[model samples]
Target chain A: MTRRIRVLIAKVGMDGHDRGAKVIARALRDAGMEVIYSGLFQSPESTARMAVQEDVDLVGVSILSGAHMTLLPPIRQELDRLGGGEILLVAGGTIPPDDAAALKAQGVAEVFTPGHSLEAIVRWIEAQVAAARGQAAW
Target chain B: MQPDREPRPGTAAARPADPGAEVEAARRAYEEALARYREALAQSPEREGLFTTLSGLPVEPLYTPSQPDPDYLAKLGFPGEYPFTRGIHATMYRGRLWTIRQFAGFGTASETNARFKYLLEQGQTGLSVAFDMPTLLGYDSDHPRSLGEVGREGVAIDSLEDMETLFEGIPLDQVSTSMTINGPAAILWAMYLVTAEKQGVSLARLRGTIQNDILKEYMAQKEWIFPPEPSVKLVVDTIEFGSQHVPQWNPISISGYHIREAGSTAVQELAFTLANGFHYVEACLQRGLAIDQFAPRLSFFFNSHLDFFEEIAKFRAARRIWARAMRERYGAQDPRSWRLRFHTQTAGCSLTAQQPEVNLIRTAYQALAAVLGGTQSLHTNALDEVYCLPTEHAATLAVRTQQVLAYEIGVVNSADPLGGSYLVEALTDQLEAEAEKYFRQIEALGGVIAGIESGFFQKEIAEAAYRYQREVEAGRRIVVGVNAFRQEEDRPPEIFRIRPEVEADQIARLRRLRARRDQGAVTGALAQLRQAARGGANLMPYLMEAARCYATVGEIADTLREVYGEYQERAVI
Candidate 1:
């Protein structure tokens, strides 16, 4: 049997608040994905470094500490430099819609907000993984 | 004292004589009450805008004999008596003030130790250590999972060596310590024990608390190293171990603080936290330990949130409810078992980053509520906590806030000053009823673990949080800096910035430890741990061994993951 999609869930910067990140991690795990949850107060460099080393298919960054204005873009830059730009990057937290759009433009595949259902997040991940695999096949 | 004469609202006498007249009578009574309230409100327009609380229990224009007569002794007995709603102790802060513990830790162990010493010298009565991300998640400083996260957020203790340096000068016997760690709490606790032993203090002599409440970790906190079943087993092991070894130590502080911070309302926090405590009690019962043996040492931690009366009522109700349940349902014989001793931390989530200094005021209010609610210990959040780590100056002021309340403020002179007040009593009764309703719902759902799996608790918290946020946005609730009084001003002067090199130093120390520790001994112990994990044996003893052998938190967690696999979050949303 093929292996399940492996994901690493992380919280970057000074956000000790981990409710949203944890819920998403649990949801992803329930969707039959292998998950490694690196707990709170992580820096972008550290998160990116862990993602690369863990060899996860996706890195889910949940930041609510408002440091995302400085943290996320550098993590995206680091992932690209590490040659895992192909790896899926998902962001979630208290991001405003406009900022979320900007983050997606900067290469975050998707952003899950507070009201987003777990089913929606799981389905989105499955679709993203499927789409990536399809592109690779082509 | 006198016989009942007239009927009050919601009572049978207040209703109409005939069944058919009920709705009309109710409507007329409501209209009359509204008219009377409007007439009163015309004089003071400012009173019209104020809400009673998040619970939607309306405040009366004036409470008189017409108001409901509440039971004083039944609802709130004398302090230190059965149904301890007044206060845990009769004297309270008048005799001894609440322990002013500043949760301080960041950077290297030496740095945290220095901070601890500094805070102690500044008249802080107790120490509360905050571990970094890696240590909390059971990762070593040098783990691939650690990276630039080592000591930047909080102190990183990889082994006994780090633990030793963390408490080098502090006498564990003289002052109590509280570690806000959950995932690897048992290991960290063992490290503390080993440190105390090295310092010539017996394990029995040490007094401290470990946030070993793994149920909360799964339900709200989400910092578990193992999955729920095993995680709870580990917690029970700590409870069992502490009961036998360290009588003075609080092995698990079943925390409602995190649940409240996770956005649960006061009642939800109370109900859910109490339910979690019951679940832990049941787990210990199954472990073949007597209730009174470990129950006295079991403590609780609550968040004193922005809702003043709601928070106070929640605390009062929690104590009464726990005492009743422990005595009646659980048949716990000991008076200590009946007492619900808790530590209160002012809600960190209520602090806003918009106007940082405003957090000090918010924290002070919450701290006052905690004091009125009668917490055994308290930690006031620093002003800059909403934005960054608390600088020495900010933390000192936070500690001083507690001291001022303890000394200058005469709040502690009398126990439960608001105990007999009609408003507070009514609110407490309402809160107790609401919590009871929740208890029934959770019971129907098969208790806390089942409620967690079904996402019942999470849904309630989310809905309440959403409603509260809406209230804030719509001006129903006012946070001075967040929704009102909006302007950028001079920021709080004392904000501490963690030096990035702290992570480098941690990693370097981790490397040296790995190189120096006997590789053969480490491997042998790890092999034994792997065998034990697969054998359905208790993981705590093996974890204790690992901690004794100076195994990094990550190595043990990794090995457990290899054996038991990791948890999968089922999408109840």
Candidate 2:
């Protein structure tokens, strides 16, 4: 069988809102992805380091406390700095479309906000992993 | 400022009517009614949908006067009496309407101060302060950890000056303020007390509550600066100190707001919150404090969710449970200690980002339930909350929703009007029983702290959250604007924006204060605070001294951080 799609979910900064992060993490695990949740209060540097160390194929960060404008770039930069540039990064939270668009432009593969289903997120992650893995045969 | 104990209304409603005689007569009548109902159901079979509450608890098609309560009067009791099931006050809202406390804060202290003034002018009965994540986490605006987070979410108060500005012209004695800060609650609370002192207001005259319930922070909010043992000790210190000096102030508000927001069912919210509150009571008792003294000031905060009747039932159950436990178990003599007064905030998780206008209706109904459920104070969520903090327009509408509910809706005309309703009574009984089951389970886990240590609460909340997500995904839960009624164009609502300059302005202000304040005084006060923290002495007085000397939140927190190491939480999912 193909290697299980590995993903890491992170909640960075002083934001303690983890309901979304935990839900998404479990959804991925149920979707047959090997998932690592970065728990609460992860720094950008530490989150990126975890993704690289875990050798995950995708990293999803939830920034509900509205610090995406300040925290997202560093998380992206640190992932690239730590030789995890290949790891596709996605974000989620109560982020508005304007900031979501800016974050997407800054290399976030996708942005999921409230009202987005866990299935939609799982599907997005699955498609990305399959495409990145050359659409490997089942 | 204490509520008068006279004039109870719901209490005089009716006695339970002898259960033995009534149950037999009602049973025969109920049987006939049930048979007829089944015959009608067989012909037209009701609607093709699940008959369940928002929390997924099964609801019967009809409720009848069955066996009812074995000892109903003792179990529910009268309003403002033991087991205050109907309501805490005799007249409830008829005596005094629930405080319309809008939880508002964003941008710089000055900007938030303006919003506060505007809200007070708009007939908001109380003030609630929402601090930014940095302030909530005990970091200064200039701290590296506070970058991008300074005043972005809520007001940032790095020093006494920020707090002084935040409450500039507002007299501390006149207005009741509730601060939503847990991890650094002691520091923020001290800042508030010092602000009152600067205004020359006696601490005894202070009427406010600090969300200093740290156990809930560890279990649900995940915003702890210190480990559980010391964090709770700090909370007890505040309670003991508050009871002695700030007698009118509630030092801690045992909260299930975040617990419900984190996806637990209403029953879990009630049980876990009461368990946490009981733990605090036990902790204070261990510290040699009288239960009557501190428990009277002990308050609660609950979330009013989408299920109107269910949320109402939860609140009713909460009151009944707390009253019984406080009087029977904890031996609190003061009726004030037994009364469970809570401030309810409508569920933010229930609001949708899609078709944001729909959230107003949802919030209005939730507010109505809170009023019917006998909330002492309420904070209605704004329509734009799903995206960000409420804009001025959104915030005004939120307050108006409460105003409408209070003034126009006529919900306050009767206290616990649903008290005798068969369905509500059944739900209250069912919820109270369910909460008792959870209480036993939590006790088996060695109480709240041990439950947190074992990740029991985290796991339970996570499972519920994931299940809720799946329910929405499967279309089992038809959330308007999300699953069922999606308008093709789901435009974003007007969002309140904290200026990009807020962080910079706050930092500059902090630097300016640091340059002018007595650096030696700051050092001396923080040292004394550390010594008190090292010993068993209450840290509140020393903290007040530090706040008096203008010691920054970060400095005082870091000083204690030296002695009580920071807590690192592991991922449970």
Candidate 3:
């Protein structure tokens, strides 16, 4: 028996371009992952609380309004503070290379850009979450 | 055209008298030719692989005249005639070219001002302002929640002082400026009017558009401040005020640009935008304003996507639908009210980050569609826009894209160049029918606001987006550099980064303005705005007073927030 992979697709802050977030949520759900979507205008603290409360395996934060540097790191720290320290943090949207590197340094496990496929994201999340649980090798 | 749908008298009876025998002869000839066409399709070499637009509208292998072909005059009259399928204006692009308005903003007010001057120097006709996220969401630069977001995406505008700097050297009456602001559009619009007053321009001479279509904000763009009722009231306030004072300005640019960018189908974009426009018109009528007084200035904004013919069909269908509805359904007696004037922008969602330069080709084609489909104004997206704000070179190229089309392309020689083509007319009719289907569904759901509350528009858009991605992933849809042409590695393009100091600089400026402005006047004006929000009075006058006194946009918005609550929607994905 295998545990279902649970994930939270979060849109933090005031970036209202949620197309990417919504699309990825459905893709992950179709791939058999239990997904929790934090709608819009969510603070970093509330996102972290929702991630912990939902007991998700990963938190995929999306920001396209070019505020990733000011918004993503706090979500990472808040998730760590709320006892979800090991929860995988992933992000995507108009993030530049330097900011992507900085976000990685601050604790984002992986970063995707506009060109990445939904399949690639799903595969990466499944591999990382599956590896963390030490589940059977598919 | 039907007499009831005609905007002017005596135009319906002008069609040539029916040629009874010739019409029958043509019908028989068409039926015989159609059988041969079917035979050719069955024996085709490639079998014509599933040709369809991104809207899921099936495209036929070939189109020819139907039995008893439609009368030309009835279907598409003169460009300026009723049911304006050909175009809204008769002298389309001959007297004046479509406004080359590129949507540009980033960094501080001074930086954006420099860019605006540079664009004007490069022959740009109109100024389209794109506010940063904080300004778009109605937050002051110094707000704690505005942390790293000030001036990141667009220009940071916090007060009348910032608006003054934004248009310092530029005269408002000289060039039309369009602001891409919703949510707090009333607050920002008040700022512009006050800036015009400071610039010493008459309010009656002001011309431009405010993207104040908040119904779409709740349904698609989702940058709403107050809930539906209050936000719509504010929009009506602007329309009412503009009709009286700023007679030349377009108060509400009912937009489908954001809706299409939000991953809706082309037909859904057409349907949803017009439905939202209807909602605004009904709101104004409910407020006891004449349809003609405010409806003429109500313009539209649409998206030009990579689907060449599909996008054109959407535009044509939009014009015809609007004209018919205004004249027949709403009984708008004014000819200007019957015309649907829209500005088109090449779709940002169509631009891929990979092989970023190829986005130029996509944009050029999309701009061509907009021109061929009769856009009154256009903003071509730059290649670098997918990753960051466009660099100067890229933005210039975007402006140049329009210049070449205007000068060299000869596309503007006549109105609706593809007007009479069998395929184009059929597709236009198809799109109109499809849009009517969606309109009926929306009406059944009680209206645009009700549909938003029930999450209907959100769910429909999500499904379409998912379907698109699934098709792309399954190799059914080929996105040039992303899917078909396999590039081993993308050479990272040169990126333009907004300076990190922008956030701090804007915050300090906002704090200083708050510190120096007449505190008592600010409080008094905002109090008045709040009172008007609580009562039945129009809020625009109060907002203008507040803006004239250097009241921050957030202060006025927050005061209204105290009166009318914020909007919150459930996640639909």
Best by lDDT: 3
In order, what lDDT does every prediction score? 0.78, 0.86, 0.87
Per-residue error for B390 in candidate 2, Å, reads 0.8
Q: DockQ (Cα-based) per candidate?
A: 0.10, 0.78, 0.77
Model 3, runs deviating above 4 Å? A135-138, B1-70
Output the number of the DockQ-best candidate: 2
Instruction: Point out the higher-scoring one by DockQ: 1 or 3.
Output: 3
The residue-by-residue lDDT of candidate 1 on B1-573, one tens digit each, is 223423433545556578678656555554554354345344432312333433656544322223222333345655666688977765455446688888888989999999999998988888999998778888888776566567756899998889999999888899899999987887788788888888999889989899888887666766666677877877888899899889999998989998888878888889888988999999999989999998999899999998898888888999988998888788899989999999999998887656667788889989999999989999999977655688777887898888878766557655676777767777887888888888899889988888777777767775666566556656788878666787865643444667767777888898898898887777777788899878867665677677677787777778877876666545332
Each candidate structure's TM-score, on Cα atoms with residue i matched to residue i, is: 0.77, 0.90, 0.91
Each prediction's fraction of true contacts recovered: 0.03, 0.91, 0.84
- Per-residue lDDT over B1-573 for candidate 3, one digit per residue giving the tens place of the 0 to 100 score: 312333233233443356675465545544654464345434433322234444667544333234345344345655666677878766566546799999988989999999999999999999999999889888898887888888988999999999999999999999999999988998999999989988899999999999999998887888988899989999999999999999999999999998899999999999999999999999999999999999999999999998899999999999989998998889999989999999999999999888888999999999999999999999999999888999889998999999989876567655677887768888888888889899999999999999999999999998898899999999999999898996865577778888999989998898888889899999998888878888979988999999999999788888988999988897788
Over B1-573, each residue of candidate 2 has an lDDT whose tens digit, in order, gives 222222233222332367675556544544554465455434532333444544777654333234544244445544565678878865566557899999989988899999999999999989999999888989899988899999988999998898999999999999999999898888888989989989999999999999998988888988889999999999998998898999999999999999999999998899999999999999999999988878999999999999889999999999988987898788889989999999999999999888888899999999989998999999999898988888888989999999888766556655577777768877888888888889999989888888998899999998998888899899898899899978876455777788898888889899999999999999999988988889868998899899999999999999989999999876799
Error of 3 at B298 (Å): 0.8
